[model samples]
Target: MRQSRFEQAFLAYLCTMDVLITVVSWLASYFISSLAWSLDFYPQQGETPPFWWCLRTVPAVILVSLLSYRLSGLYQLGRRWPLWQEVFHVLKATGLMLLLLVATTFFARNPYESRLASVIFLALTSVGLVLGRRCWGIYFRLRRRWGLVDSKALIVGTGRLAKNLDVALRSNNWMAMEPMGFIDDGVHSSVGRATQTVGGIEDLPKLVEEHGINCVFVALPLSRYAATKKILRLLRDTLVEVRLIPDVPALTPLAVQIGELEGLPTLNLRSSPYSFLDGLLKRTVDVVFASLGLVVISPLMGLIALIVKLSDGGPIFYGQERMGLDGRKFLMLKFRSMRVNAETESGPVWASQGDQRRTRFGAFLRETSLDELPQLFNVLRGDMSLVGPRPERPYFINNFRESIPKYMLRHSVKAGITGWAQVNGWRGNTSLRKRIQYDLYYITNWSIWFDFRILFMTVRAMWDKHAY
Candidate 1:
């Protein structure tokens, strides 16, 4: 699709801000260094290089900074990207720019080079760029919310796809799209009274002209290929942008990604959440936090173990087989919170709010979630993650997969000690369907920041009533 004039202008504005921020960051770094020790970070040295000499690097700084941003693909990133992703790109670009600046100084044989000042500039520019992006995001959101910058959109079909798109457009204002109405056959009325059908496809041009529509979204099903072609042919003379949203009901759960294979367009149906970099990042987080967690809580764990042992002279810890990524079963460790033979008669029953299996202190351990502390070892051992869907025993997994269609999809990632579902109060036999829904939501939108959010919520919800 062609870029709108507004989009082109916004991009130019951002580029201008990036250049200006870099220049200002350099000046600020020099000013900050002036108040401190001398600005001599090289063998050549004199007391803080002449203030006039600082201006010499402005051209190099601006060029390198903009080049770094473009090279990091920040220029192509859309506003739909999450805030964390945008911030990370900015940081990555800034780091690259600083590296380039240092290399240039070494090769240019400059008489004045201050590594300390460069570090300061790096710190300042990172914060400045992030804050600038945040301010722009706020402005963009407010403008869209107030209808100051928006595109009038018209749906070309009235079906399940069209209805879903309408709901999505209304709920997610970040897209900055305003729905004018639907243009389809008058047979369907499920789109609601607010967005009434203007007319059939023949009347699309008239409706567009009347409503000043600038965007057309086609959601016609595969079976209506002829009708879709006719609609596209009719839209040829119009100046509006046309986007085709494929109506593939069978692959609704999987997000569609456009790619190329052997010079032809290809669509991927199933993809793992952990790309190579994502795996490395998550594993690093798990190993670091899990190792630290075990070290910090070792004394408390020992106390819990003693209490469990004193309660009934049984095993201090219990290991049970639970399924993890790709349906791999592993021994999951936990501080035993129930009597030795608690499940001997029942075979495999879920813990309820209250039962006769507790030994007084065991109930407290379960309620306070102290019993799950041993899972930190599993995280460090690479069998689990700090945040993911909670694993279940093979016995229950067998039953759940039979009843729930998307139950097995959660195994695509390693299980967690505390998860999105558990933190959201969907645990302990509340509603299996709702728990699966939250689990799927987490898996679909997995990110480091999202995991942190779940962990924070877990701490706040520790005293929840459903923990039993």
Candidate 2:
């Protein structure tokens, strides 16, 4: 859906503020550099350049800084980023802007540009942008809290989807949409007692006029296409915006992408979140870290291998067939933590607490998660990643694929040695549903920074009770 007038105006205000801030920061940086030079705090290489020469670079600074911020996703409206995340983006964008500005000045042979001013500009711009955004966020949040900028919204159904949308809108108050009530035909009565059923479909226009709703959310199930169409037609003459919340059963975990295929509308039910560049970056990280990890841990691995071999005279390494990306099977490697025929009789049973099949050393290995260290080789082989959904054996996957909703969706990305699920204590005998939930969350929000965060968390989760 196109952005509403309020959102457009808000975005325009942000851009204008950013441009203004850039110009001010540039001017302030030059002023500070000049003052520092006069005070002997900054080394005087030569006579300071004229102020006009420095002022002339304002336009270039704004252009490069705005472009950097835009490319860094600083202007993506509706993002509920935390303060630290916003500051991080500002720092990253400011760094990029500084690099571009320096390159432009150097290539242009702009002798008037001062190195001291450039460094000062980077610091001032970063701090200015961060504080500017933080203040704006606080101002808008207060406005929203006061209901000064809130837009009233009406839900067009009273079913589960409608109720869920209401809860979502309520939770994300930053959207500035306040749910006025529902507009269902009373066919479904699943809405909570707190949410009022104001009127039916026929009373939509009247209710819109009465409550002055800014938008209408049509959250009817797909089975009620006729009713959905009628609601859209009824609201066509009104100024209220309309948005459809598709009720695709069992696909709630996946993101829905709407586009057009040859002028016809298309709904992409399943798609990978990673782009080519993202995949390249993730693979680069996996390869570099995996190689380093294997080298650093080789001595420990050798010791473990020796102990495993002498403890039971069994194979030092175990290879188990497991499903990975796109349902492809790979022999996932692990330091054998069980007897050679551990699963021969049981036929792929999950290890439980105090499982009799586990060797004494194997239990320690599993507890410390050293057993999974060998999966680094799997990562280097491109069969897995440093962070993602943990791969499951095909035997269990066959049952899970049928019983659990969106279970196989986890395989959309390569499996990982340690994962969001494992770090969240959802490994081994935990709730499969919750594990799939975390795995899906990781896939949908995958990023190099996110992977690093999960990897760091994995270190702290090594001794979790669920590790067994």
Best by TM-score: 2
Q: lDDT scores for all predictions? A: 0.82, 0.85
Q: Cα deviation of 276 in candidate 1 (Å)?
A: 2.3
Candidate 2 residues 212-248, lDDT tens each?
Answer: 8899999887778678778878888899888887886
> For model 1, which pairs clash?
none
Q: How accurate is candidate 1 locally (lDDT)?
A: 0.82
Model 1 per-residue lDDT at 417: 87
Superposed by TM-score, candidate 2 places the C-alpha of residue 261 at a distance from the truth, in angstroms, of 2.6
